[model samples]
Target: MASGTSVSPNANRTRSGNTLLVWSLLVVAANLRPALTGVGPLLDRVQAELALTPAVAGLLTTLPLVAFAVVSPVVPRLAARWGPERLLGGALVVLAVGVAVRWVPAAIALFGGTVLIGAGIAVGNVLLPSLIKRDFPTRVGLLTSAYAAVMGGVAAVASGVAVPISRAVPGGWHTALGCWIVLALTAIVLWLPQLRTPRPRSEAVHTRRLPWGSALAWAVTAFMGLQSLGFYVVVTWLPQVFRDSGVTAGDAGWLLFLFQAVAVATGLVMPTMLRRARDQRAVAMLSSAVSLVGYLGLVAAPGWALLWSVVLGLGGGACLVLALAFLSLRAEDAIAAGALSAMAQSIGYLVAAAGPVAFGLLHTVSSGWQAPIMLMCVAAAGQVVVATVAGRGTVRPTRP
Candidate 1:
């Protein structure tokens, strides 16, 4: 029997509506990463002003991921009740407040505001794939590639520009931190167009009871989380890691830039390559290999570590982009995409939140950098193991 998926009279209207929504989603997505990733370069300055110990500084980075991890599980349900349009918009508004709050003189307010931004970002991360799935069903790989590429490009720009912006502005760290509020405002502006009608599908999702009762689904979700855990650990602390290895700050920062910038290319290219390959295992393994080599090089040779960091960045960037692609690949349809997004990110980010804190605690306890280096090696090895599982050509056990 033919499926009930016929072109009814309202089909064209639905298509027109969703197309405009997708474009707006892309704009919002571009802003999200820059806000989260931009803070790393300025971590030291923030610490100096606040009289923060290294442990406390690490918490600044860790808290956001913890918020991300904590908020992720409820995002699909939130989207169901509130709609992605509503949640996405509200999150940005909260993000703007969070950004503004960080500029305040008080440290308590700064930490509270940072948590709010992190919680808000958690919503954006889960919502994007759902938006892509609903609007660009036929072109998910391409569009996913676009967002990943844009995300990496923004991070690289934010990293490379953080010092310059901090130097140029009188408020230094405050100004550098507030730079992202403009992007948040832009998202709210673009997203306003999506808020006109009631989100009918989301209402249905709210009413329906979906179970998180499958092993394979959990596996895929955990796979996404662990890989991200490793990636953020690197992005958050890699520059300082390089600096400690005797590399100059200027060169070390550029290597950080290279990782993020090169990922833009990988983000654009990896999905296309994955689509052509029968299984993503080879690519996943190759990415892990590069990541391992990059880290090993950094640990083994401090002076010439810049090149390896680039390689590491390239591999890490590819891994993240591919993880996004997996959300689409394993979902049965759009609704499943949203559900998978919530599942993957909720579990994934919690796992990822450990990166900075763990690194800091290990360094603090050992009173040496060797512990963190070994920990990174272990994380990179875990990445290989996770990718091997996630790259397998199969959907989650449950059907949409």
Candidate 2:
């Protein structure tokens, strides 16, 4: 009876600890996209107030992607040294500071703080999958879906409220942009408990080098890059695209909200679909194809923006969940997951970083949205080809 009583307390503590960990992870996910997405809806105001050109305004979005690419390669080593949990808590601090710094009334602060935000998000992006693989190996799909949904849901809210928040607040766009600091601070508090956990072993710090030579690794990299490129391009410019089509700014923000909201819904359903599938190839291909159709529809008929947003959301959400899942699904173990994730995101975000700038430049050269969106169409088609190869059941061999 004493043994039974003692075991019951231990079990309860385990459950309690696990619940806190999951909530912390979800809170971290919530912080990932809101800061970036909030900027999109306010880009026009930012551009006007700062006297920035379209190409330069695009850089505001591009800077973070660049940061993600640059910082991602080093995260695995840092995670190995400090542990993912402690490092993630540090990241939230950086993110909070970045958010606060961005609110300062200087162009340099704006750009610098954005870089800091990117650095912070980059760590979380690479570590979350590895943490899931390490702690909940069997529940990767479910947890990935959960976090992705929360990420998308918060992103949608951020987009929907940016303009309204700006209008309601005295500092206008700065206030809206900086308001996300609260979320970052909250994440930091929630994540404090995780710091008490043990660090990873020294051997993990020297785990096999990144899967640079693996064909499957490159395919996964391409999949991650292309989907990220598509998503960022839309988030950065979709409001402008809608405004150019004669939509009001507030409504444009809501449309962006709708796009992400649909994505959140789709992400929520992905786990069930993943469970029933033999391999993810068909799902990947179908999602890419749907996004292709959405992009093409925008080009052919900008008037039907509402329908296209829904379609893009459906495809984009699925693609995001799948790309993240691949970080875990393709790796053989948690350490391998971190290596593969670093490899994929390092090269992938470098590719994605160019998207917003290129889209803005294309729009400048063509004098319309067609050429810019067609570029996305090409990317989506490329995704279809790569997703086929990336979605196979083959796990990435660690030594390669």
**Considering every candidate listed, which one attains the maximal TM-score?**
2
Per-residue accuracy of model 2 over 350-374 as CA lDDT, tens digit each: 9999999999999999999999999
lDDT per model vs. reference: 0.73, 0.91
User: Per-residue lDDT for 1-400 in model 1, tens only?
Assistant: 0121211112344766667666677777777676667667777677788898777887777888888878877787677667677888998889888988887767887798789888888888887887677656778888888888777788788877777788898888777877788888888898897776466452245321232775555656766776677677776777777777786655665677788888787777886797898877778778877877877776677567668767877788788877887777777665667677777887778877887888878878998767877777777777777676677654433433
Locate the minimum summed-lDDT window of 10 residues in model 2. Answer: 1-10
- Report residue 345 deviation for candidate 2 (angstroms): 0.8
Best candidate (score: lDDT): 2
State TM-scores per candidate.
0.91, 0.95
Model 1 worst lDDT run, 10 consecutive residues: 1-10
Candidate 1 colliding pairs: 225-348, 229-352
How high is the lDDT of residue 234 in model 2? 92
